[model samples]
Target: MTRETPAGDLTLANLTKTFGRRTAVDDLSLTIPQSSFFALLGASGCGKTTTLRMIAGLETPTSGQVLLGDRDIARLRPYRRPVNTVFQSYALFPHLDVFENVAFGLRRRGIRSVGGQVRQMLSLVQLDGYERRRPAQLSGGEQQRVALARALINHPQVLLLDEPLGALDLTLRRQMQVELKRLQAEVGITFVHVTHDQEEAMTMADTVAVMNAGRIEQLGAPADIYEFPATAFVARFLGQSNLIAGDVTGGSGDDLLVTAQGARFSVPAGRSRTDRGPVFLGVRPEKLHLATAALRVPAGHQHLDGTITDASYLGVSTQYLLRTAGGVELSVFVANSGDQQRFAIGERAVAYWNPRHAFLLGRRAETPDPTAPVAGEPVGVSA
Candidate 1:
């Protein structure tokens, strides 16, 4: 697991992949930094896996450069590239014991006396006691750990994971997510993980690239992309959002005025690209404030009138569906702690939120709060 060159950054320049008449990936370019955790996230058939395979040299790019630092590895064979992949199936040999599976790479490289290395890898993945057992004797999580040990033992410059957690149950998946993040921090190798789970990407990755229709729809830190989405699809796909159609008007200070169907809403001017134009203002469900009466709207906040169309109490929180006077439906989340007042389904209410929480298309983040997903929600983008 040593190299003449240091673990180098991975870069894909104008990469493209095609199958017959289908274009799987098109003119994609990305620079995955060294010793970082990066994620390619999208829905099924969004080409995230295809992009990962190209990086691993399993699928040759129709065009582009796959640079391992300054050297191009796109034309090299999978075995020749300084990259390793962990697939969802574990892909461990059924007849091989844990020790043998973990030692397979060293043995293939003509290296003898691999027992110590195998044991160390087993300990790294917390499977030291199960070395003698075969893959069939272990649970799904254990088998996956063994697979990880096998791939990590090679110590490639970059490790590619293709839906490695897709097969696990909810509890095991949650546990492994913590394990994976811990291991990545320990090794400090660049990991490019591909998954359709937004929660997974936000939870583990230092940076997330949201792919769509063979192109990157958005790329940034998890919170940056989530809080200030670049498009309507990113807003709805990552999590539930209330997108109000409006037009940008003049501004005062950092706030801009927006008029939506005769109702005026304020938005942060610094996060918007245009001073006056048609724009779709987006806010998360939890950001909106709901009140039974017309309370004084705070400074830099706008108020809208709505009626509770639906309300569901979920113990810790209450979810309400509110319809504004202009017939625009919006979702509001109210905390159930303290002396929380409950609103009936037919109760008229007003929703107020700070203008700074609003984000516009093709703009920076509106607030310091990272646009990250909720604590426990699946993330994927689709129409």
Candidate 2:
């Protein structure tokens, strides 16, 4: 059954939350469009969860308002607000069957006839025949779907998902990502998801907000943020970036020339976040190509001479670590197309890429911790 919801954006105006002297959420303001899929992405303790809680009426803000359209719901009780939340635990009743669990909300609202709604929701989640199963009898993915169906049956103004897929295995989690997007499209209501997984955010959300230190560091389409990060923290958090600390020397037509480690490189002026003084020239690992030093680099490419310090051959691509004479390490990723040149560890090579692929970033307020794990680093995990 298709239901049309009244269109109204969810707006947070100067919202803040504090625990004792520690501020969990700073003075933050944002507008999430109606019927759009939005993601709050960050590491643990970054306040993404707290922000979601405030919107769901589970946590009260120390200041500011939570507005749905023109009405302020900041002071409303959780049951009074037209919002529903699905947590990592699913939180389904252990003694109730799938049908009863999903029908609980409608029953509580004094609706005696919930058969049709429960059946439709079960089919929507692809659990039509599992209506009698208990939560303990279902698989992790099935339990997740039941939880989602229960939330959607209420016809919420906004659906809040807090790491809802965290408990599933890799394959099940990937499958559920697709299912969640499909369900959102069919229901056509605002979906605000909070997650720490970068890939999950990139794959599921229409817009992603990267949070740091109780504030949004960057917000945009996944591709835009990944390609042109606004801050050093964003550059490193979204994915692997080969950031080269450089000084802007001058401009050449449409590009800004930068000198890093005595090597000259060109960055497109439009792609740069800063134009003067010192900056970090950033490029993704996959954008860089490695070649033997004897081979000449193409005319339009920026080149750096380095020695291959490490090489890892994954099935689909090869990752190489290169160290230059000036002691700068660069990561390069090459697709494993047949007949491509292969370099061995300790071999001298040239790392080159088109200048258009590079972006410039200003220094961050706090330098990134050296020991923190880099996003997108390959590990021995399931596909």
Candidate 3:
């Protein structure tokens, strides 16, 4: 049995939440399209969860409106609003079996016959045969599905998931990521997920809003956000990057030449954050390639000479830490193969990459943290 929900767009206008003097969510505004999987992603206490709670009417906003389609639902109580939330805890009634647990909402709404619907939802979450099992009898993932089915059975206009997979183990969590995406597509309703996991957001959400300090730092498709980060936070949070500081001194056709430590680097004109000022030129670790010191230079590629300060040979790839003679440090990742050139610590090498893959951002005024490794120091980061 298919449940067709007439989903409507959800909008938050100037929404803010405060706990006394501490503001959890600042003046935030975003419109989530109907039938889209949208994610509010950020680190813990960054206010992603606070934003989701406001939308679901679980947390009262200090100001502003929550709109469902054209109606203002900000003042509406949680049960009065057409929204459902699934939290990290399954929150299933311990004594109730799966069928009754999923049917609880339907019965509350005065629907007498929930047999067919429960059966369909059970199959939807792949627990058809375990319909009579209590929450204690099911695995963590199964309990998660029961919680999902219960909230989704009501066919809410919008569904809010707050770190729903946090308790599951890594293997199960990854599996649930795919399952959740599939369920969202089949149900065809707005799914607003709040998570701190960058990979999870990129994998599941059609659009990801990276929140920071009670505000959205960047919002876009996963690839767009990863490829072209709008802020320094976005660049470092989305993935590992090698950023070089430079100033836009001049230009060529559709490109600007930046001078860093007497090294002229070409950046596409569109990627230039400013017409003529300081900017951070960046590339992802995986985008950079390494060659032997004596190798011939490739045409139309940015090249730099550096000493391999460190190298890690993981099964699938080799990540290298390099420091240039000018004291700039970088990370480069290369696929591991039998014929690939290997590097030793302190060996001289060259890092070359296409200029088109470069990313640039406006410079920030803050100085580097005093506790972190100083210039030309190598640091190990997990994959």
| Clashing residue pairs, backbone N/CA/C < 3 A, model 2 | none
lDDT of 2: 0.89
Query: How well does candidate 3 score on lDDT at residue 227?
Result: 91
What TM-score against the true fold does each predicted structure earn? 0.90, 0.94, 0.93
Instruction: Report the CA-based lDDT of candidate 3 relative to the real structure.
Output: 0.86
Candidate 2 runs further than 4 Å off: 364-383
lDDT of 3 at 83: 91
Candidate 3 residue runs with Cα over 4 Å from true position:
1-5, 365-383
The TM-score measured for candidate 3 stands at 0.93
* lDDT to native, each model: 0.83, 0.89, 0.86
What does the lDDT read for residue 269 in candidate 2? 95
Error of 3 at 98 (Å): 1.3
